[model samples]
Target: MYMNKSHSRIISMVALVATIFVMLFSVAYSSGHVNHHCNDSADCPICSMLAQCESSLKSLGTGLIAAVFYAVVLSQIFTVSLDYKYQSVQTTLVSQKVRLDS
Candidate 1:
C-alpha cells in the first residue's frame, strides 16, 4: 500500500515537472518564432501557437499563485504545531523530575 502511494506521488511529480517544461518551451518557441507580418487571418499557425502559449502561461501563473499560498499556509501550520509540541514537553527541572536537595 505504501509503495503504491509513493509510486503515485513520484509519477505525479514527474508529470507536473513535464507540464511546466512544456509550457515554458511553448512560450519560448512562440516568442522566438513570432510572426511579424500576421494578416489577422484565421489560418495563421504562429498566431494559434502564440494563443496556446498565452493560455498555458495563464494556467501556470494560477498554479504558481495557489502553490505559494498553500506553501505559506502549510508552513505556518507546521510551525505552530511543532512549537506547541515542543512547549508541551520542553526541557525543565520539573519536566525532568529533578529532586530538590534542600
Candidate 2:
C-alpha cells in the first residue's frame, strides 16, 4: 500500500465528496419523508431510517464544519511560512564562490 502523495490526495478527495453526497442525500430523504405514514410501532423502518439520518446529520455536519475551519487555517499558515522562507533564503556572489580578481 505504498501510494504517492497525489494518489492519496485524490483518494481522500473522493472519499470526502462521497461523504458530502451521503449527508446531502440523508437530509433530503429525512425532510421529504418527515410526515411518513406509519404506525408508531417499535420496529418501523421509516422511523428507524429517519432516526439514523438525524444522527448522521448531527455528527457529519459538526465534523465537516470543524474540518473546513482547520483546513483553511492550516493552508494560510503554510502559505505564509513558505513565502517567508523563499524571501529570506537569498544567495550572494560570495556565497556562490564567485570572485573578481585584479
Task: Provide the TM-score for each candidate, comma-separated.
Answer: 0.69, 0.62
What lDDT tens digits, residue by residue, belong to model 1 across residues 1-102?
Answer: 357888999999999899979887987887797745677747988777777888888888899899999999999999898887433646888778999789
- Clashing residue pairs in candidate 2 are none
lDDT of 2 at 97: 90
CA lDDT scores, all candidates in order:
0.83, 0.89
Give me the overall lDDT of model 2: 0.89
Report lDDT (Cα) of residue 50, candidate 2: 90
lDDT string, candidate 2, 34-65, tens digits: 77887774689888889889998999989979
Query: Local error of candidate 2 at 13, Å?
Result: 2.7
Off by over 4 Å in 2: 72-102
